[model samples]
Target: MKKNIFKIFAALFFIAVIVSCRKEDPLNVDFSKLNIDNPVANTPLDTWLTTTFLNEYNIDVIYRYNRFYHGDDRDVAAVKVDKVQPQMQTVLEGFLLPYRKVAGVTFIKKYAPKQFVLFGSGSYNPDNSYTLATAAAGRNITIYDLNSFDLSDPNTIVNKLRTIHHEFTHILNQIVPMPVDFQLITKSTYLATWTTKSDESAQADGYVTPYASSQPGEDFAETTTSLLVYGQAWYDDRANGSTAAGKIALKAKEASVEQYFTVNLGIDFRALQREIQEVVRNTYNYQQASFPYWLGQNLYKSLIVNAAGDPIYSAFPLSTPFSLVNNNMKTAIAALPYGLTYNFMKLNFTSSTAMDIEINFNQGTRSFISRYAYTMDLDQATGQTKFTIAAVGGNDASWVGNANLLRPAVQPMLDYLSNNTFVADWLPTGVDAVNYNKYGGFYVLGTPANNFYGLLGQ
Candidate 1:
């Protein structure tokens, strides 16, 4: 009985050993039957992006909406199909190309972010603040708010380019860290909640912007980006306007940034700035043939006469029935008696120094237009703006009577024109239909109490 039990136990142990040593057959599956979806298809935009970004610089542009591109926690929308190209074109022209030209193609290829991800709407925060663009690990960049991009609008163009410059600055700093002294300059001013601070307040505290006051890294990025994007004039203006300590701090920061680029990157910071400024100027050339807001709309002229019934200076015409003719040009068409419709006054910018002001009249019998050409001079030394009538009627003798009637009204314009130095002081307040407010006309520069004419659009 003992021998039989030993043999049975030995057989059980042998069976267990065989089972453990035995190998299982590999699982067989057919990849042919498996369904696979290609997320990124070869479309025209894809080919263009591949050619423009990927092929050139090994950078990938992901315009198609993917939640994974944005973090899972962030709720952002995809960029509209149509807005993608214009916005990208503006960015390439205004931001990247400038850097490529100044910093060199090799420098950008080496330092530029490897991937750019686009979104249509801004990334909204719990505090109601929206993010325009951001970069991660110095490799991926995400730009938001493509839906409202307008290539023609200077403000929009500047703003979007500003974001790109700001983020790119971060990427640059990642490669070569900012000077340690930069943080010490505004060490006490750094705040986590920078949104509460206004730009003016931040400037007073030795920061370029409120966001710059958040941290030293952000401060460096803001200063560099602002200098490059807004140009030296804008930087100087801001620095000049700041408080004494703020000015010192700004200059110190500026010196540090300039040194970093020069020493580390072998780049002339000012030359880079000029290159960027030229690109921006070409993109949004303010000198293009476009009318100022005050010109194309109906203006109410107020005439002021002395007690002796002599016209001292007539304010702009009081509710003139004239309508702008050739909206693109400075000619106005007014309805007159005897079925006569004529350009009341055509203001022409003939040359840099000359402006031709033409006045016309029907007079019930015959109609004639008189041209009063003026040669303007701006006194750069005294900062005084002046304009004077160099010639009257432009050799036309037909409407001297109409020119006489229009002289009083046009004189204030000439006087206002004489103070052309004030043109720089005019700020854009807002827009009303096709007309813009606070650019020109009477309401801008100073109060109506100072000037006789008010540019009101009806």
Candidate 2:
């Protein structure tokens, strides 16, 4: 009996030793229960944020069991764990979660945000900055890497909400697209050495800022951010202030953005922009002062005039009774603003089969600037033609002030007239249409109205 008892004890001791030898989960650590005075037991996190904080955007949370700790000396390292909510959720709610819920919302999601990684401070990457949200193609966002997750950042709107908003902007534009013509406005003169130049010099060139001239993708994201975050007035002010180039750059961006959302397909870009600013006000728990809101209101007004009665386009020949006539051309002499201006184009039709458009952009103000023309031909087969807009260099608004950062991009649009083009027509001849498409540095020139004598279908 004594020998048997000894054997059993030895077996138990071996089992204990084996269990103690298991490896630690590098990304998992449990902080002591968050003794927040009674977070309701078993209540889902989404329910908590909604019932307690009043958000209407759908909330999905995956808990991460992790811990993180910080100090200059790295002496107080604590394990960290947290959860990830959707990046889209924050963006939707940034202004109108409730309205979206009623409307059955839309957002660009090539892939859903990743699993909320739960781990302790041990999982923190020494090389990573304060990342409240992150995504891998196959994995979910790993929250709780509490480096810059500060509640006290007075200058930053850097909570989980703003972080998600910023990241989602990246994800959406990645999937959808911005106008190609925006790049044509300033083409190749974009600079890396812009910081060395003053804002005035940069403006003379056509960039909104040295920073904005960085890249095509950056321009799209920043443009989206500006409209969605600051609203149109803010965008207008950035263009109008400081330098001639900045203003010019901004105007092109504004027009392209309007064209993209209104001409292309998406949310009412101008209206949604207003809604986004309103979201910033509501979610962060502050009402915008009248001054800022009007700035936004006025900014939108610049893009579209007040429509108290019937729209003038209602009278166009496409919708109204009319016939082909060459005697009428809309032309007027006026000083172009710091932004965009248009001179009428003439497409001369020869016989019943051939036609071509003669295009010339504005001459510069004060001292005469250089002039250039882009030519395009109408197609008989596929109904396609090609043309290029300038990429850089137009003093049309150069005297008004331009953002040097954006000029390189803006100048390309002017230069595109000099570039080659390949155009596509969805509607064939005779069915009058004023279609517009923006290639990177030029506006495409193919219209149903080009060969207006008779419909191709006729």
Candidate 3:
């Protein structure tokens, strides 16, 4: 009887132990701290921010704090995250309390897309502890030079947040996906070209960036970044400097961004842009609030596609530069500078091949040649004039006003019968150019001295 009693007690105790051990709690599970930040080791970082941040932004974050490298015993700290779980009773009460009547699983399945990351101390990178989070593909983050973060520099902190959110926006867009046609631009050329080429060059060729020239996926991602993080104004400033080739690529990209945000993402890009500017103004307390973006926008407007969705092209078609001698020469020019108009083309052609010979201040009609400047071009085969004449320079760089000052000022007249046309045939073919603005225009003075800014007038 004693043995039987002892066996029963042991069995009961064993069952109790198993039950206790099997009980799972949401807060205490040990997460990996593999990145440079190593927040897991720095604090008892729980899943507190998980549920909290998501309720506000519909995001989820995953964390991994400590990591190790393979050979030299040095650490490469990068951030990578995967899942988003809700914790904190306070957040739950506020969110769930309102919807207490509905089922819990239903809510989880409906409204939110969880946000999570794996932050680290040692990177899986080649260099220092600099961190980069790609919210688009392979949803991972690698933070470098861990010590570099001041935890100060309000600007830096804000940028970091912005970068993370920017990548997150990309991922969401990718999943939902923009039109595949948007991804088709420059499908053959995307690399790290954005950093390499100047905006002037990009605009000339109809692209937003040299990198954007590489492929469509990159273009799409860049377009999303341009629209969301920097907003239309910043995008405009950056794009205004783009070359003719860049402009074409930019147009495709612009259309994609507009479609994605308005039709797909279900957000107002214009209102969002305003909201973004407001946030920046309020957060940083800057007097101008995106001073660079707004400043660049003025010049950008001249390029075409004003940030407010306006078209500045019809007035300046190369054919009717001043008024067509005919439309054939205008047809072959391909593209022209931004914001130019028939009213602006006040010059007339005096020589052959469509050039201008016009009076300056009503004093003398000087003979000049330009496809755009001299709208009327003498057709070699037909013995008739077709192209029109227009002014190629800005207020400061007009040939009649400051004929001797700037080199690019006379490009319209000079390039017509000169070597400028076939000067660059070595580049990619199938590229027929028309209406491209010169790299720059000349200005004679600012308070009696020469000064200039941007590609076109402000």
Name the candidate that leads on lDDT. Answer: 1
Q: Write the per-residue lDDT of candidate 3 for residues 368-401, one digit (tens) a residue.
A: 3222343433322222223333566434444543
Q: What is residue 56's positional error in candidate 2, in angstroms?
A: 9.2
Residue-pair clash count for candidate 2: 85
Q: What is the lDDT of residue 244 in candidate 3?
A: 56
Per-residue lDDT tens digits for candidate 2, residues 108-169, read 22233423342223333354323344544433444444433333331234244434444544
lDDT comparison, 1 vs 2, better candidate: 1
Question: What's the true lDDT of residue 2 in model 3?
Answer: 100
The residue-by-residue lDDT of candidate 1 on 266-297, one tens digit each, is 88776677667666655565221121211221
Order of candidates by TM-score, top first? Answer: 1, 3, 2
Q: Lowest-scoring 10 consecutive residues by lDDT in candidate 1? A: 298-307
Model 1: CA > 4 A from native: 1-41, 286-458
Q: Please provide the root mean square deviation of candidate 3 (C-alpha atoms, Å).
A: 17.4
